[model samples]
Target chain A: MTEQLRESLSALMDDEATELELHRVLGELESDAALRQTWVRYQLARSAMGGQPVSHARLDISRSVSAAIAAEAGAETSRSSLRERWVRPLASLAVAASVTAVVVLGGQQLYQAGSLEGQSAPVAASGVSAVGFVNSLGAVPMRASYGAQAVPQLEPAARTAYRELARQRMYQYMQEHAEHAALNSPQGLIPFARVPQIEE
Target chain B: MKCVARQLASSVVCGLLFWAGGVAAQGPVCSEADAEALQWLARTVKSRSEVAYQGVVTLQRGDDMQVVQVARSLADGYSSEHLTRLTGQGAQVVRPHHPLNCTHPGEQLLTLGDRVEAGDCGLARYYRFEVGPGERIAGRQSVKLEIQPRDMYRYGFLLELDQDTALMLRASTLGRGGKILERFQFADLSYDEPLEPRSGMDTVHPAAHPHPDDPTAGARLSVPWIVSWLPNGFTATDAADPEGPRRTYTDGLAVFSVFLEQLPRELRPGEGLARLGSSLSYTRGMHLADQPVLVTVIGEVPVNTARMVADSIRVAR
Candidate 1:
């Protein structure tokens, strides 16, 4: 029991004690004289390490606080019973409010990130035929709006080259898909007709 | 007044009985009509390979349209088809037909001699077939058939067939909310016209080969990649190397292809989506075999389906 109290006292000294550990150390200090003396010594040592002056005499405030709590136990319990009725409901409401706030903030952050990326680096208009066809349809107004609003940021030439390479690869895959689809499809050459005519 | 009300109630009862009889008559007739329509579709598929015909077809997607002249000749159990784009810079494709084989399961299922078993194709299970109203197309009497998909994985199709020849005169791809995404219709057709062989015609500029990757010349080899998830009924159809490894999947009707290629060290891959007519392509950057690779999923499927396929690709252990 003494060893456990010592561990809790050490945790308290290091400011790493959990609420339960803190309570255990305080309770032990009120009951044990030797443990109290050891805690005082540790505090003095910590003070000396930081070049702070230490007093030899120490006040036992925990003893009085524990005595006062013991004396008021019945009345305090009655008062806390009354407070608990409203506190439980308020606690739940606070938890729900914080969760909602977190979700709203998270959604805002995502929107900001998307807009920032849209502004910082405009993707090159790849798939010319696709964009052209979609533009002609005028169905997705956001697609057209994006094209109009995109202000091309100063991107490195290498990035442009990379995009071109990617576009070429996409066209290659599309053509291959069309060819294979032509063979497998029961619709005959209709699959071939879906292949986008890449503009040089 | 009571006598008049009784007479009116009896008349109402007679009207409802007549309507009920009409509905009962319509039920069997509709199913019979659907069966007839399916038979016509089967006939269209069978005749496509065997019939010799010439026609001009117009392909339209969004605002883009192309006119193509198609000629087919069947001689001695062999068929040859030639297609020439009449509009834009002339591009022609000739598919020299060979003996039918299991290479094309779709075509094999449609072949008259080797028709698929009733449950093999499962067309009725996946799609609802209905005979729509008749219409005239290409100056020929035509019957419309609606092939509605039972699920979101496949797009619906509206087909207009020439009533006499049973040839598909027009086809439309239907999207969500019954939107027409693309249409292919015959502007002119003639079964009696003599198709002249244009063997030496060099007017074809061919579609642009903007990339060095020759998709047609890809070696048919399976790559060391596995798809962890796939939509129901989809099966891997083919895998080929077109500058990289490509895997194709199909659910009998709808199809998608996934291509994996290595990216240069300096190039950082980004994810994006592109839509062409009724088809969508989703692309993402992934690491496989300790190398950064670009994965692209292209198909006539919903965007989410393509994205799921792209996200599910992983290296096979």
Candidate 2:
């Protein structure tokens, strides 16, 4: 985290952070996981000093979760994993550590299609296109917003055909890259989000 | 009784623990095993192709939501999975297990340092690895592992690895200034034995996508296209492949590809930048001799950086 962002976080704790500074800190917190922990730490330190009875008695989930992971690692290497589904009630177990994780994914749609308003201003429509780069799930076809340069030279019918080809090529590239990345990095199948539709 | 008092007194101790956890490289060390999520991450990478599970995965990128039913199992020591999209036109892709030709990042680590152990790429040089709080996702307990990039050349990832299986259940790529570029999470996941692995699916639709390491590629050797500038750590991992109009690079975690294809016609389009979630495709068209050659850079890198990479490519004589 940058020193400027850290200062804003400190200011946020003192209730003296300006509106812009709050946004900046929150913005940094979203990208930087380290910043999120620092935010939590700052909050914990302030509350600890104020004697504001700590809601989370324990600070980290280091013991229980780590034990769960270590024990699972043992079960995994033993080759008996996934033979029986083990669904333990982790929520009730305040047994060892307390971790404050803010995963705001409470069943809300993450991004809104056509939210590409603040990007670069729309210039003249370029011939080379992005095929479909916006919030174009199925309903939202490629709008004119920051267009992914559709090759304008092709005839109407040919343009559609080219768009389909481009979409397929792009999807293939994404999946192929994902496949290689999954094999190369620690992020497993998380990279492959199932291929996008090619036939439209 | 002592435990209760310790809990109360833990408020003061929390401050010291916070500093130890925050200022240091790793996450707040809550337990000994969770000291660094790196070991678990190594396990996570190993567990991916080995785990057998069927799940409904939802992918969200810039308001673009796609849902797919995925069933993956170990077949001949690699992952053979069938994915049927639940959303859009229901397009499906079946990938039969085959020899993966890509080199592991750990294999690429030897060039960096001779002392590094196998399977360790020394990712800490680029990312601050941390273990986040445990959370439930896809109806199973998961451990949140954060991979924060130390540089701006690549994006960061927040992954949730299954506690029991170690398969990544959730991955969110963060970019565009701390906003989520794409979030892929399993809506529901099941690890019950005897998973329906590619038995009766119509696998005839889309043949396997061509692998970069496929030996049967018609092209024998690739022309060395000099990339003048690259983000500090990225190395050409695809150089050993059958020479094609493409090149791929990875800096241990992030990966990108450069494709320079020469077109027959003189009609060429202007430079354009398109994005699918955090992944991007930046196409630049230029005339190589009398013909136009389009050099496109594709991957999960920043637009400006990708554009710069595209700008830096030059065909070697």
**In order, what are the TM-scores of chain A for the candidates?**
0.29, 0.26
What DockQ, between 0 and 1, does each candidate earn?
A: 0.06, 0.07
lDDT of 1 by residue, B146-191 (tens): 8887644578888888887778789888986789888889888888
- Among the numbered candidates, top TM-score falls to 1
Which sections of candidate 1 miss by over 4 Å? A1-170, A198-200, B1-38, B100-103, B108-121, B197-223, B239-244, B266-270
* lDDT value, residue A116 of candidate 2: 22
For candidate 1, lDDT tens digit of each residue in A78-162?
A: 5576686767555434433432233223222332233322322223333334312223212323435567332222123223333
Give TM per candidate.
Answer: 0.56, 0.54
- Tell me candidate 2's interface RMSD: 13.9
Off by over 4 Å in 2: A1-182, A185-194, A198-200, B1-35, B75-79, B99-121, B197-224, B240-243, B265-270, B287-291
Interface root-mean-square deviation, each candidate: 17.2, 13.9
- If you superpose only chain B onto the true chain B, what TM-score does each candidate give? 0.74, 0.73
Model 2, C-alpha of B206: deviation from truth (Å): 6.6
